[model samples]
Target: MLQINDLTFDAWGRRFFDHASVSVPPGAKVGLVGRNGVGKSTLFKLILGELPAGDGEIGYPKQARLASVDQEHPATPVPLLDTVLAADVERDRLLAALETAEPEQMGEIYARLSEIGADRAPSRAAEILSGLGFRQDDLARPMAEFSGGWRMRVALAAALFAEPDILLLDEPTNYLDLEGALWLESRLKKYPHTAVVISHDREILNNSCDHILHLIDGKLTLYPGGYDAFERQREEKAKVQEATRAKVEAQRAHLQSFVDRFRAKASKATQAQSRLKMLARLPPVSAVAIEHTTPFVLPSPDRPLAPPLVRLEGVTTGYDGVPILKGMNLRLDLDDRIGLLGVNGAGKSTFAKLVAGALPAMTGHLARSARLKVGWFHQHQIEALDPDDTPLDIIRREMPEASEAARRSRLAQYGLGAAKVETRVENLSGGERARLLLNLVAAEAPHLLILDEPTNHLDIDSRRALLDALNDYQGAVILITHDRSLMELVADRLWLAADGTIKPFEGDMDDYARFVVERAKQAGKAPTQIRAAEPDPPPKPAPARAKVPTGPARRRAEAAEAALARASQALADIDRALTDPGVFAENPAKAADLGRRREAAQAALEAAELEWLEAVEAYEAMKG
Candidate 1:
């Protein structure tokens, strides 16, 4: 368990937290939520003891362990498995101990050896490495060969292998594909230790966390539920506050009206003075500013396109001599909401660029439907914006035909007000630039939209807005985003660009994730299967003394015994069902029903078996 008391953090004269207090109990799974640049990461660092707190106490158990995967992964040139294995110092020591133990000493160290063999051996290392998407052959490769994204995975694997008591993850899912993200989600759910994660992916947080903590305006507020529940409650509270403010303001105005009218009359002067004093004592009502809502309207094409909005045939793309996409063939259909998935630097972006006509495809035929308008938003779109130009100016330049009034209206939709729109692009924050870029893309209304990492710098709300807009659009879209929640929400199909080929997946993102994990598990197992240590023995007969005296007595006893046996069999079935992930995946409704049935069956089986054993014992005592 960990606790923070009276924590305060300040940066450049701006206070992020003032006397904030928070506690994370053992085995607690909590999410740290806030707007962009609100010091979520800073608070995490403060807890981590990496930075000195301005004022407060951070307390944890003496033996408590902590580990984290930083937002910016450090550069490393090591094989992925080796990097992960480096975290488990104890595992290495145990392995060494087991290897060097003498034959005479082995018996005395068997208990220690068993502990290591069960949980800390090379098998565990291998299992975790494979679970994280690393192949057996890749384990021995040097870490220097992997890209930034793969390097980040190495760091993640290290943190996981550390098996600390508390995990502080900052955007762990940022670079993960749907498969990797889902595997992480599964692991976190069953993880024995507590975790406090700061993430922009809504689905990951919602699926993995049991509680939500919001840090806003130097205060900490805990919500006793997941992201969806927290959002609903926050919205309701805001509405109530607005209503209360309105009512208070109306009463204050009524009191002021009485004073204004009666001040002229001498006899009413005293009463008016009393009312004025009362009005002055009333608390001032701060006006609740309405958030500017941007209405994103994608322009409808005059004509709809047929199949194959974009196509790539025999494409070979890569830097230098390395080919990422080799003789690749891909076709994007009209009105298809396609999700491009693969590991980092796996030609996803290259394919996107090839389709957008931003890069040349070597020895390939690139084609697009005639009259199809394409609007492309790359991952580095912020760099594309002019630092000197204000958002208003950019919008005007992009939409020259639109009236000045309409241009401002479009900007307001993305939370850019009239005053802020005039601010220079350089002065705007990363999240602001992200919103502006999305707004610019929405203004074009192209029939085919190709976006690469569109949600990179967006906050939770802005990501939702962009996702909603894309969902409503009736055009062909090829989107590449690391936000798994956004992909699941908007994508109708998936295209996995891996190992020089693009494979089309004809289901939801969940199905694709399941497929990948199952495949990885199968790939990790050896071809040979070890036989069981021993086979089950045949059933035994009942004792002769326990035989019933007559027909009715025998029938009742047989019925009871048969019912007990059936219950025992049912318990065994339930145990087997729990091991099969497919049982939960293929039949959710059946799975839910089986859970309760399993508990009931188990209890009944236990009671019946106990009674049967007791009966056998009593019979043996009487015979003796």
Candidate 2:
């Protein structure tokens, strides 16, 4: 268990906590949540001992191991698989010992390997990577081969693969697609150790965490159950606090008025004095700090939208002239709300770029309405902001002829008000910058909006605000984001971007999620395969028959039946061995060996049963 008592810390000339305390029990999955700059990461740093606490004590089990995702990874020649596998320090230590141990110590090394389950480390690492959207070929690739987002995934995979006693994940789903996020949520559900996940994804927090730790106004409050429960509890608490504050203020107002009106009168002087004393005795009530909703209201388009705002015929383009989309034909109606779906590195962003006119098609006819004004947002655009310029400064330059008052009014709608408007771009948080970008785009009153991962850095409140804006938006939207909730709420049609083509998905987001996950599961050459990608290629047509003698088909069915019987018997024997206490108590080495053997036997039995079923089906088809 990890215990924090009255923990207090100071950073950037501000004291974060005065007497905040919270306890994380063993195997507890806690979701840490708060607005930006509320000290969630600072608290994590203090727990990790990277920052010294100014007051109070934090205690944890002496032997507890910790694992956390790093935001940056050094470029290296090490294979991605090896980098992730190295996260298991115990396995690495054992392997290191093997290289230096004496001949007599070989048995000890082997026994330790069995105990640690190091034999399956390679496959385990690969499984984790594939779940995070890495292909079969990516495992052996060098770390430098991947982009920054992929490297972040590697960091997450390494942290999760470590299986530490305490795992700290801050925004782990930020860089993940819906499929990868769902896969991760499933994995976290089965995690056996303590974990604290810091995320803005509602579904992830709701499904993965068992508890919620809310940091508000320098005080830590622990709530029971998941995010939904926490939100309910918080709302209840806020209502109760508000009611109490109202009563207190009413009484205080009555007393203060009496003192003000009659304090100088001789007849009522004594009564006023009594009222003052009574008011002083009453406890002070501070109203709860309500959450800030995005004040960023989007202004409606100045002109009516025309149909077929964008049209592409025989579109083709790729990075460095390697065509990704060839002979593609797509049209965007003024009211179109299209959501792009694809796995990582599948060119979703490339398609968005092509539509937004950020990238010229290698060979295609691109047409747009004369009144079409595109508001294109991309991840790279965040870096393009001038570091020295404030949000207001940039807007002023963008709308040169507009009055200063107009620009400030527009930015104020985005919550940049006065204080944030003058702040340098470098000083703004990612979420703040995202809001500014949205505000800038909204100011243009464009007929078509192309947003790529616009909500990647936004908080829940900001996301809600954006969702509301999109629902009310009159412009055509071409969106590419991993936010499933947003996609479901805003998208009118789903488009699949894969296999070097752009096409409409026949089903909803759930169907697309399943397809992407299946793709990942088929990633590499692994011993145990997930359900086959395409499913048994529509079986061969059977010959028409009324009745036939059991001949070669019967023989093959009989052989298959025999194989299944043998496999089942072997599994039963292993199960019986596992149930015996003496088998494990007498020999730890033997027990660990049996455990691995049982898994293999189970897989073999499954395969054997499948083979038998196929044989029976074939025989039945032949008879038909």
Candidate 3:
């Protein structure tokens, strides 16, 4: 569906893409992955024609729609649902035409609208928004009511709702919670048309995409299958390349030896000349380049803390007198690795603050071991860094008692090299800044760490490095991140922030994912009711009359409708089981099994719904 041929682009005294060529097959979901500052976004800009390539071309079918969420949706008075529905230009055009089109044009217009499923646009838009973390009531609220992060999700929702021929998403999970990310992953897997996503989240790349597009050294290589498959294939290819290079080097040496020995003898002069030509004709092989990422340095506490380093009893805390999290009773041991799960605004951050000692309980007892020390790293810290401040300046302040040499050495240990130490924070890459803060926060060897959305800036390799550091560190952890792979690998226990309280989540990530998907479906189930809040559009004149549906078409429609109803009921039952806290708390294994069943039921319902839509359309066509 898309092709890039010998594409060369240059900017800022560097070549971004040099003779890079690749073809993306139709209907393929491809993950575009590379290291930071490696021009992934630049390539997107080139594809979108936002940046001019120095040579070659990016080609796709003419008139094919391409959509991307380049930035947050503008803050406007338009309701979120209408803002998303307006993304479908063709549907909007047809709807507008209904008011002024000649009576004779009405039939064709109505047919086209039916063909494009225009009647379902509002609900479809609502479904996308819900998957991206919008509440049921949020759909009817004005866009201006949302924060920038929420607006960013709205932009993503609009792109997905538009269902362009080619969809481009850049780090879509960055703005999302784990719930939203899981939903998006499921949604992208079923996207009908082609999609190219730029993501560092390994789980999304492995689960959502069919192909991995690697951009490295100004070249593009498309590997069939997911991120894990790409790594294996690349490793094999590198091994083969190294073996071939060795073989070629041996042949070259032999040819050169023959030429050197015989070039001095007249009898073998002619043969030597032939060997010389052969030696010169031999192809030179370049050694395979290995990619390396600086490992994160997270110091473990020098001494182990006693069990139950932190204990809370009926803890209630929030801004001012208003409580955001209530009746929070939890214990954190020195060795506990707690995965914090919740949608945004579900009191995850507030709980983190309580644990970090940044916020005190308003009405309940909270206890921590006398010698307990805590290190907290959060997403806001990166944003809160002074742009004009240099790493050197920050390090100097952080280590006022240490020698200058020792401070510089510490920054270097944090992956900030000599060249970057004096550079302003604004000039540093997001990964660099993240690495600096992550290391600095843990440098004192605290007994407990509270990390909130810690992997937002790190690439896949860096995230892996962070995971390695976390695994090796001997400290309690309360981790909150959208990166599922890291969370699954690092956390041995789970805590959920929900219903205005913090409680133990007995099930694993799989169960939680199912619960999230089902909850999103429930949130968007009444899209028509939500859309009713909008001002009604002008009345449309009816199209030409048609014959009634035949028996076969009617029968098919009725059967499909019945199947859809059955599937929906089955899924609803599963959703109830997944949502009940008691199911998980009582029998964890049974809860996990129910999660798998829920997934199957969800797929069945979607299939039945699609079949019903097709059957209804057929019935409508027969009537016309």
For this target, which candidate reaches the highest lDDT against the unseen true structure? Answer: 3
User: Per-residue CA lDDT of candidate 2, range 344-390, in tens?
Assistant: 76688888888777788899898878877888888888989889989
Mind sharing the TM-score for model 2? Answer: 0.79
Name the best candidate (by TM-score).
Answer: 3
lDDT of 3: 0.88
Candidate 1, residue 189: the lDDT equals: 72
Stretches of model 1 off by over 4 angstroms after superposition = 71-78, 93-110, 116-121, 239-308, 311-333, 359-366, 382-428, 441-443, 523-624
Candidate 2 residue-wise lDDT at 291: 84
1-624 per-residue lDDT for model 1 (tens digits): 888888888887799889998877789888898888889989888888898888888899988888888843455666555566667776656556778888887675666657655344444555555566666666666777767677777778777777789999987776676557777777777777988989877876788888888888787877877899998988887888788889988988898899899999999999999998898888775654454334445554567787778777887876666677888777776657788887555688888777777777677787787777888887577887778999889888888999998888878877788788899999898888877776677565688888888877777876777776776676778888767788866666677776676776444565556655565455445312222121111112234423221222222344457779999898889878877899799998878888998989988998887766665555455435
Candidate closer to the true structure by TM-score (higher is better), 1 or 3: 3
Candidate 1, position 178, lDDT: 58
Q: Give lDDT for model 1.
A: 0.73
RMSD of each: 21.0, 23.6, 19.3
Runs in model 2 deviating more than 4 A are: 250-281, 522-624
